[model samples]
Structure formats: structure tokens, C-alpha cells
Target: MADGIDQLPVVRTITCSHPSHAGYEKDFSEFWTGAPDSKLTNRGDTKKWNGGFRGRPALADALWPELRNYLIGRKPSIFNNAITALRAFWRFLDGYERYGMEPISQLSDISTSLSILWLNPIDEMWSAHSRQAHEIIGVLVRNARKREKMQSAWAWHPYPRAESTESKELPTEGQIRTAMHLLKQSAYGIYARWKRADAMAAEGKNLLTVSRSRQGERNQKGQLKRAFDFELTEADAHATYRAFIASSGNPLPSMADLFVALGLNGKDYPPWWPTYSQDHPQAGQVVR
Candidate 1:
């Protein structure tokens, strides 16, 4: 991300066409069957009008007639993004339909003066719906004007450019479940570390002098290292830190002094021991 990482495993949802081939579909059946098909079918002879548009009754009656022109020569990828934006724009307008629908009618008639809808999207990248819908409307009106031997309307850009969009749909249930499972595993790992600290404190009497018999340990990067010759326990160092508080009477404490008090040889410490010890805070002078 240019800003920062929002979530891992970049995932998205895609929208597909659904058939409403019963009501207004009949009125536009010929249009769908007529020509160079949409990018959805790779513009093949096979005809369809992307999930049939149930154009509002008597409103924007010319939209269905000019839809084929909108789909003509559109790239499939661009078409998908356009359709997705349209769907999002459509849902977004329901709340303000009184201010919206008229733009469709004006698509085929400049004389049909009406205000265009203001689409305020949450994510700026999703603002493409305005341009996409406007361009499609321009195609419809310009062609309709041509048929009547009238001057075509200028295809003016209505909104600023935004990043390409796929769809505005949220993540699916499967994606949520996968994230939850990974998070649970991470939580367990943290719990295990805390348990290890507790166990070391409880069994401080049986501390290990050398850990040569134990398995090799892994570092933060998961790299395996040679088995340690000495094991450091958290309890003693934690105790040392509480008592290691330096004062005017007591000089500052070094980790070297911490090691001697704990009765452990520094040479026997593993590569990871320095980091581990700092976290546990070993002390040599603080002991006897």
C-alpha cells in the first residue's frame, strides 16, 4: 500500500451478470440479439446485455435501444470494472433517487434539462462510476441524435479520474474465516511463550547448567541454532531487575554483572541467549 499495509492476503470480490430476462427484457430482446456483442462474451455473435437492465418504466426509454453501442468495442476487463461501478452507483442512489434518475432520460435528450447525481464515494478509487455512467449516456444520446439528423451532444467528462476498480463488494465469508484461523494460531503462540515463562519461574530450583541434551532452538527469524550449553531462566533475572534499580549510592548495572550473579558462564550461552537474557535480565552481583 502507498499509505500503509491495511490487511494481508490482498483479496477482492467479483460481480457477475444475473438474468432478469422476463419483464423489460422482451422490449430489448432484438437489441441484445442484434449485433457485435458485449466484451463479456468477447464481442462474439452470441448476444446478451449484461444482466438485462430493467430500465425504469417510460423513463430513459432510449437507454435500452442504445445499450449495444455502449458495450461495443469495450474491453472485457474495463467492462467488468464499469459494470461494478455502475452497480455500486446504482445502490448508492436509492437513498437519493429523487435527485438521480433524471440523468438517464437526459442521456438521449439535451432538452430534458435535469441535474446530474452527485456520487460521493467512500474510497476515492471508486469514483469512476460517474465518468463511466456519463460516457455510456453520451454514447446513447449522440447516436440517438445521429438517427434524427440532429447535432450530437458533446461527451464531456463529469468527474476527476480515479484508480481502476474491480468491484465494491466486501470480502466473502471464506476470507473472514481464513483470517480468523490465522489470528487464532498467532494468539496460541503468544500464550505458549507466557506459559514457558511461568514454568521456568515455578521450577527455578532445578535450573539447567548446560542445555546440550536439549533440541536446537530457533531464533525470531526461525533459523535453527546449535543447542545451548546453558539455559537462562526468567525468574532470577526478573528478580535481579526489581532489585537492580540503580541509585546515587549504587552504580549503574551491566548485563555482565547480571550473568556472574546468576552463576552462569557467558561462554556457555547460545547465540540467542544475549537477546533472551536481556528480556529476562540476568544478574551476577545482585546474588551472593
Candidate 2:
């Protein structure tokens, strides 16, 4: 079975007596008997390959489409036993009768000349059906050889040479959502501030406005038309009175000067103001 590996015929029958099929049989034998047995079971030959070449487990009948979709859609065309084993195994089994049916007289003998081309897979026939099967087998062979090399190379080297792979902490879903929300909110705030500044510059810089009249008389009534009259309002009297008391010795502005500056008169002034003292000893002249 091992010699003339390329010319080895398709599996005609799987039986315990033939030690020929050992590639995947060992691992699969455990499935049928639960415990590993000495050799292949009598039932092993009769058992349907069911996609498992040696002893692989059967795929659930319902998931065939999902499995097919997944395998076909996968990138890089994964060429592993899980992908190609079942189909090739079944093909070999079904084609068994047709392959052996040919007359023995018609069989070619390589007694005289050797075809080293067969020993080395010729590129011309690389895409051939039989050769494609070998190609898949070659992938497994190359993988096994690579693993063997890695194992042998590492045998004498340090055991802990492989760098430890540390797991990283990734942000949570909530954190991602929060970050997006904050970015959008910050963008809106910046835009609002820019628009507000533009609007403020367009109209004289003001965040609030009071009613105004275009052609009103310049009297106490005109106070209503002033753009900013907070200093002339009723609150202004109280604030000014407090300031005057606070600055009593600092030389107060004369009553006439105050009336002119504040758009007021001694006539319109409250009764308490007429008696107020203007005679500070230090006040040689009122500071208007």
C-alpha cells in the first residue's frame, strides 16, 4: 500500500484484514466502538463512509446547506480534510467498481522503463482529476512535513521561546456609543458658539434686547427707546443711592449735575432727596 503510492487503486473495500488504509482510520475507530480497539472492526467495512473517510463523524443531515455556504464563502479556499475529505472519499468509494472493471490484459506494466514524471507530479497533469485529488492530499502532506520540521527544530531549543500572547481590554459597546454621542454634541456646541458670535457681531454685541422707538421725543419717555436703559431704570436709583452713600466723602456730583447726567430734575426727584445734605466740609467744589 505504501509503495507505488501514486498508482495505488481507489479503495475497493474497507476491511480489518487490509492494513492498507491507516491514514485516518486510527482516529475514527474510536467513534464506532466508544473505546479504541486493537484493529479495525468487522462492521467498519460495512459502515457507510458517511463523509468520514476513515472514521470521521457524519454531518447532521439538515445543516448541509449552511455548511456548504460557509465553506464556499470562506476566503483563501481552505483545503483541509473538513472541506474536501468527504467528497473525495465518497468519489473513491463510488468509482471503485468502474476503476477495477477494466481487463487485466489492458493494464500497462512499468517493468521496462520508469516514469519518474509520475513520482514527481508533472505540471501538465497537475490539474487532472486524479492529480487534483493528489493536490489536496499534497496539502495535508506538506502540512505534516512542516509540523515535523517545526517539532524537530524545537526539540533541542528552549521550551519557553514562544512569546506569551497577552489579551487586551477593548472598550465596551456603551463606551463606544458614549464617545460618538459626545463627538456629535461637541460639534453642535462649537457650531452654536460660532453662529452666536457671528450674530452678536452683526447686531451690536448683545445677548438680550429691549423695546426701542425710532422718532420718540427726547424726554423721560425717551428712556423707553434707549437700547440699554438698565442704568436709567428704577433699580438705577437704588444702586446709585448706595454708591453715593459709599462715596460720601469722595466729593459727590452736584444735584444739578446729577439731574443732567441721569435725565432727571429736582422737580421729579423723590421728596427724601430735597433735604439731603450737600455741605461736606471737604467739598470746596462738587466733582461733576
On TM-score, the leading prediction is: 1
lDDT of 2 by residue, 1-288 (tens): 111112322332212222343332212222221222123448755434222222222221222323333334333333234344434422232232233321111102110001111222121221113434434433332243343342111001111134466768777999977875675465345434333322333333121122323343354433323324332322233234323322332223455544444444433442222121244232333212
Q: How many residue pairs of model 2 clash at the backbone?
A: 0
Best by lDDT: 1
Q: Cα lDDT of model 1 overall?
A: 0.38
- Looking at candidate 1, the ten consecutive residues that score lowest on lDDT are 23-32
Superposition error at 47 for model 1 (Å): 25
- Backbone clash count, each prediction separately: 5, 0
Off by more than 4 A, model 2: 1-52, 56-82, 85-130, 150-288
